[model samples]
Target: MKRFKHLLPVLLLLMSLTAAIISCKKGGDDPTPTPTPAQPVTTITSISPATAPVGSTIAIGGTNFGTSPTSNTVTIGGVVATIVSVTDTQIVVVVPTGAANGPVSVTAGGQTAQSQSTFTVYVAPLKPVVEISGTTFANQNWTRDKIYLLKGLVYIPADFTLTIEAGTVIKGAAPDQDPDKKNMAGTLIIERRAKIIAQGTASQPIVFTSAKAAGQRAYGDWGGLVLIGKAAMNTTSTAALPGGVRGTVERYAEFNDNSGTLRYVRIEYAGAAQPTGSATRLSGLSLYGVGNSTVIDHVQVSYSGSDSFAWFGGTANLKNLVAYRSFDDDWSADWGYVGNVQFGVAVRDPDVADQSGSNGLELENYDPTATTDVTPVVLANGLQQTAPVFANLSSFGFGTTPTTNKSAKGTGAYLAGLYLRRNAAVAVYNSLLYGYPEGVSLGATGATPGVTNNTIDLQGIVLANVLTPVVGNGVLTSDLTTTYFTTSGRANQIVQSSDLTALRLNNFNATTPGFLPQSGSSLLTGAVTGGKLANSFFTPTTFRGAFGTDDWTTGWTNFFPQNTDYDR
Candidate 1:
């Protein structure tokens, strides 16, 4: 039919070119496949506080968290926190000072997300509640899981240091009963060249109580620990320390002034009384003029109303001292304290006294009619006149009788058990004055020319159950115990407390007693052995007085400071 009309226009142009190649492959193939973005899954699912503390601020929540907090990150416990605010379902960070306890990831876009459990980072068994006060001078540490909080006269001034780490606990406050605010006492003053590392061990010590609250605490309730150094003093000129109480004068630091370390410390229920004069108090450690590189070992001044480790002038050389239950004077030195103590331990509580008479070592010098006159201040300060060289002392009093009826005329008016008097120049070795009424008083009745020119050295002492073992005001009577057992060099006993019941102490009026010393004890063989304490700050212990068969005041001494729990 003539090729069927030429193939009917070529079959209609090949079916219109196959319908234009199927309409250009159904409208240009595959250039629109770019809608697949949904991979940003950074989930965390709730993290409000699962513990949080290292500078707290948690709150993580859930989901993507990547609307763009710079595409988010977070970490925590792997540390990197500090992200403040992020969105896409919340983020808020900051728990990174050393963020410890684990998993809290949360990446974003790159997709990370951890938190399902394990966050727990609030480790402060005490920290936070820092407070302090005034003058500092930078470098101040205090960490052992902090408690700090002094709040009044906290000064450190003159080239500061103040470290304090080993299990610290500070606390102070309370005591503004407004006697014009009583100098606002909460004291910590270190002044002078200021320094106080406060090392502590014997199982973590460093405490300092009185934020009152634990049997409502007592005794002055705060304001104590004052250091103030410059080494030499015998009144006059360094503003005559003592009642003039000058601490921050700003110079003088010699006698080996390194003013730092104080190992295994504990000073509970501090002093606080000095608002103005009279028996001017403030002590449980007030070492003005501290030096000799200042270390002071294993200290513990408990329940002191005043004077329990005082030293208006210092050469600073204490060692394992522990004066518990002191109202006043359990080791007090004055105007010219040339230090060197060793293993001291005083325990007294016949219902506390302190009308200027509580004694167990209350030395003094520099006041031959003061206004600065101790012979031109010891001939223009070559110093060394308030002597202070006790060794291995262990004084425990209150036992003439009365377990608690109290007043044996106010405990025989200030229970003297080693009082040494105003023109003092002491040195007692291997001591152990027990259960006293009076056992070693000397001069002080108008001082008697400083008891005929100072020098009261007693050796290897052991006056027990003393009613009056050596009194001397009409100038050293009983011939000063026959000149302290024939010229102060050999043994010197006066036993009677039931011939010294092996001194297993345990109840010198309880409250954690147990001043050790029992297995065949004659104080473990009358100490003072051959090499007589071979110097180098004497540590030669054949056993005598201040405990010797272990028990260096056991696990950081805190004889139930009114049931301790200074915020745990």
Candidate 2:
């Protein structure tokens, strides 16, 4: 009975030890870690830079991207991208050349992920180097997006039209180093019967500038824009007109010839002089016999080497013309020009001038020769009259005092406010000529008989702060003042007075200038109120100057051409 009891106690102890071992196994050591839920299949959330061109790097954002780049394969637009970097939540890859618009897919491990949105691929336009030199027979259209690099002398022949789209930019390269060619400057010429339909808006205006970098651009960087038409121009050349005759040519056009339009256009850093020619110098915008039907409004010519705007025997009227820092004349008319100009403003640089003679308005009836006589009665081309009417012209020069002549008079630069010579029959009205060495000079080669009869007819002209208000080189000064200035209709001639406080010109001599008259200025209401320019072609405004209640040159004008990036 003692042996049986001992065995039962031993059995009980063994059973208790077995229960303790079972409890320890149930509470210790993890059970296979649950496999981490398979990481949710590594979903893709989005892609950065939804649209990109070829060769651009795009980023893919998602969850659970593999750490190794080789493990993750990203394809954009069905083309495999070169994976640059990879992380757990993002991947950056370069777009391949053959990429198109499609959903970007990423494949890692045994799973594949696709972006919810499709990526866009933009095809860049091919920038072709258009070398336009010869004549164009058919219509030529220059689009806005394409970049045109102008080569040598590009001319539009007769009966053709060159249509430049709005916001189009035309750049001229540097002059070629051709020794044989006198002037290898690039020039765009529109021959008679040819037209340029460059109609730009206030927001998207056409730009003509140098191809050089902005800070490297300068005056005379390239040749200017030239438009030649079949309009009446009284030139001394009896030989047959090279382009065409106005009355007898095959496609003879009159003053109302529609030579297309040039609106809201900016011509910068132009006016390169030809090496050898009768017209050696070129202006920013040269109109050779451009008829009245041609539209030229809101045109800004800045940093011109020669005249800003010159009309060589054309009746095309201009308005809202801004001539900024021209090296030579601001507005010039020659070859029997009879066009009417209104609302023209010219701001001159104190140090810039030409040795030949620079003036605010240089009117010559005909080409001057040593043998030509200065007779006003003599008609130009023996048929036409050299009468060009100018109204509401605000010519601002660089002079502090009445006799402050900063420019070199005889050697470097000759200064004049209004140079009426060469039998020029110019009528100035409602004009302001301020700060000039010589205000108004008549007769370049000394006055002859009947000089004052047809030379100048001044009315409502303000010659303020001028060294010499009215003077004649060879004619009697008394006779000039009596015949031209002291007429019954002539009035309001201001000279050397401090009363010019009304003209609120901002930085008149600086690179950036503003010519808008301030409030309470006399220029706002001093204009003729009878609608002086109420013709069909002109829009009548009560204000006298180019800028009035509305600043037309606000949006498109670029005052600082030196800093602009033409390529951008």
- Candidate 1 residue lDDT tens string, 234-299: 665645344324443333537788778888899988887655566656787888878888888988
Q: After best superposition, candidate 1 residue 227: deviation in angstroms?
A: 1.9
Residue pairs with backbone atoms closer than 3 Å in model 2 (clashes): none
Q: Clashes in model 1: which pairs?
A: none
Q: Compare the candidates by TM-score and give the number of the best one.
A: 2
Error at 212, model 1, angstroms: 21
Off by over 4 Å in 1: 1-145, 148-157, 161-168, 171-191, 195-226, 234-300, 303-307, 312-329, 334-359, 364-396, 401-416, 421-440, 443-448, 451-466, 473-475, 479-559
C-alpha lDDT score of every prediction, in listed order: 0.73, 0.73
TM-score of each: 0.31, 0.70
For candidate 1, the TM-score is 0.31
